[model samples]
Target: MRYISTRGKAPALGFEDVLLTGLATDGGLYVPESLPHFSLEEIRSWRGLSYSELAFKVMYPFVEDAVPADDFRSMLDDTYQVFAHDAVAPLVQLDTNEWVMELFRGPTLAFKDFALQLLGRLLDYVLEKRNQHVVIMGATSGDTGSAAIEGCRKCKHVDIFILHPHERVSEVQRRQMTTVTGDNIHNIAIRGNFDDCQRMVKASFGDQSFLGGKTQLAAVNSINWARIMAQIVYYFHASLALGGPDRSMAFSVPTGNFGDIFAGYLARQMGLPISQLVIATNRNDILHRFLSGNRYEQHQLEHTISPSMDIMVSSNFERLLFDLLGRNGDEVRSLLEEAQSGPVSIEDYRWKHMRKLFDSAAIDDDTTCAMIREIFEHNEYLLDPHTAIGVKAARLCRRDKAVPMITLGTAHPAKFPDAVARSGVVSQPSLPKHLSDLFEREERFTVLDHDLKTVQQFMAEHWKHA
Candidate 1:
């Protein structure tokens, strides 16, 4: 599939080039020239396949140019080998019709691993094939850092550097990233919010000199379309298991960067009979404002119990807006600038169109805690802060009688032990094996100012001879 920039100026690129070159040179996100479709018959035909087999089917259209069939199948097989469950993403029914999709069964204990693990294998295959090196620069609110670090650490021909806001992430989140001692992995604790870390990464990418220098840079974030593609497979898997287009389903996603819900949107585009993509957010709810038509504004970050959703700007929103504007690049550009500069609103028709496909809601810290407590008390379901937000959102939206609502459980409860402990439910078997020893390790990280120049200098100095 040919990928075109959301902005008009850059030349269109193939899947491999778009995967390697993250953000477009023209300052746009890459989107497929045409969205692929799947018929109900075709979707039903995928029943009873293994996870890897289904993954290759769902992702083949988006990645066929970059990954050949044999190699892609091999990579998918290796990627899921370490998963705790045969079904990497499992569905659990919390109530009569409400379900929670548990997506934290991987090495890092978060949904980010759903994509990043395969990303690591894909990067390894591509680099080995071309005999090239790449330095992956990523900015994470919490889970993405550790998941990316875990995915890329100690791999040949790649150096991974992840920057996260210091004091903004939880202790567990910080330790998860910093405790790794791989020579090829570097972690930076930036003295600001996630927006600062994201800004620095973007600024570094925009640096022509840096791009022309020794290290070749790529992103493992959802900005790389491959990440979103990898995520889309699970939605198909979950929907098929639940009876798919023949039976409609709804999803409540605890969103921060908007990647997960965007995958749901992709599934809808692919002809799944999805009823609603409910977007669940914490205190920082720019997306809620947009969906409600109150105002779409970017503000200074606010720390929340769900630290991973503590984002002011939602990057993946651009891809959705691009589609909403009828692929009119000029309108998409104008809308983004307006939304960033101040509060802006798309026309009512546009919002109404979006509302038909999505429902948005927010839960504060107090409600998040209450939901966690209530779920455990009533249903014996233990949820972290992120999943608590999703559960609450799904409950709120269900008043409209949305059926088969599935809240995407973004991380394992043990990843946020404090929240789970506060919820008054202990694990039945206790934390998983990889996370069982987190309390025993010493956390280490280099603190840095929120300056792009400082980050560049650190990269240069630490990796000078690398």
Candidate 2:
């Protein structure tokens, strides 16, 4: 399967190259040249497969040409073996037709582990075969940093660097990234918001000359096609669990970067029978604003209980817009160029087309806390701040009450204890046994100013290219 840039200027690439190249040279995200469609019978046949087996079935078409079939299957096995749960992504029923897909059973305790764990193995395999060394630079609002660090710390051919906004991330989130001790893993606390860190990562991808033209820069962020590809599997997993393909389902995803929900959008493209896709957001709700009002504008980034969704700009929204605009790269390029200065609105027909598939809501901190408390009191279930937003949005924005709704449980509640406690829960959630001593671990990280040049220079000086 060939991958093409959303902007349509970059040369088409196969899976391996797309995995390595996070952002296109023309400032676009990579998407499959054409999605592989599964028929209803094909989708129904995957009902009882194991998580790894389901993953192989869903993702084989994308990587078949790049990775040997046996090797890819083994890699999938190895990647999921580290997850703490047997089901990998188990489903918990909340109401008659509502469910929560638990996705935080992985090593790092976040939904990102579903993709990053596989990404680390894939990068190691590809780089080892090619005899190449690379540096992975990613920006995480909270969870991605720790997940990426844990995923790639053992990789022999890669050096990983993750940046998060200083003092913005939760204690557990920051400690999760900083506590991991590895010479190859570097954590930087930038003196700005998540967008500043993300922009730096994107800029570094656009120009890698700072690496002295020796080591290639890789990405662990959702911009990488592999991350999105791996994420698409879980959508299928959750849907099949709820009697999918035979019946339609709905998903409400708490999104900041837009990659996770975009994966759901892809699942529908691959014939998952999704009735509706809900865009759930916190105060930093540029995506919610766009889907609700068609006003795609930037606002000041707000620090909320859900730090992961504290993003002013949604990077992966461009990928969806590219499709909504009928894959017209030139038009996407022009619109994005205008958007850099301020907000840009789409044509009425295009907006209507998007509205048909998506509904969105922006919940505030009060509502998020209320939802968490209410769910806990009524159902005796705990939800993290991000997932609380999702559950709230799913209840508020769901078009049909009869259709089954699944809210993507993006992270474990222990990761954000402050939010959990603030919701009036008497007992604070504790980290799992493996991470019980997270606070006791000696933390090591560098505090950097929010300057791209300085960040690039640090990468150049520290990266050990062979």
List where candidate 1 sits over 4 angstroms from the true fold.
Answer: 399-402, 424-430, 464-466
TM-score for each candidate, following the candidate numbering: 0.96, 0.99
lDDT of 2 by residue, 1-466 (tens): 8888889899999998988888999999999989999999999998899999999999999999999999999999999999999999999999999999999999989999999999999999999999988999999999999999988999999999999999999999999999898789889999999999999999999888898778888999999989999999998998888888788999999999999999999999998899899999999988888888888889888999999999987888889989998999999999988988998899999999999989999999999999999999999899999999999999999999888999999999999998999999745898899999988899999999999999988888887663
C-alpha local distance difference test of each model: 0.85, 0.93
Q: Give the winner by lDDT.
A: 2
Ten residues in sequence with the least summed lDDT for candidate 1: 421-430
Top candidate on TM-score is 2
- Count steric clashes of candidate 2: 0
Question: What tens-digit string does per-residue lDDT give for candidate 1 at 100-155?
Answer: 99999989889999899988888887888888888889999999999998888856
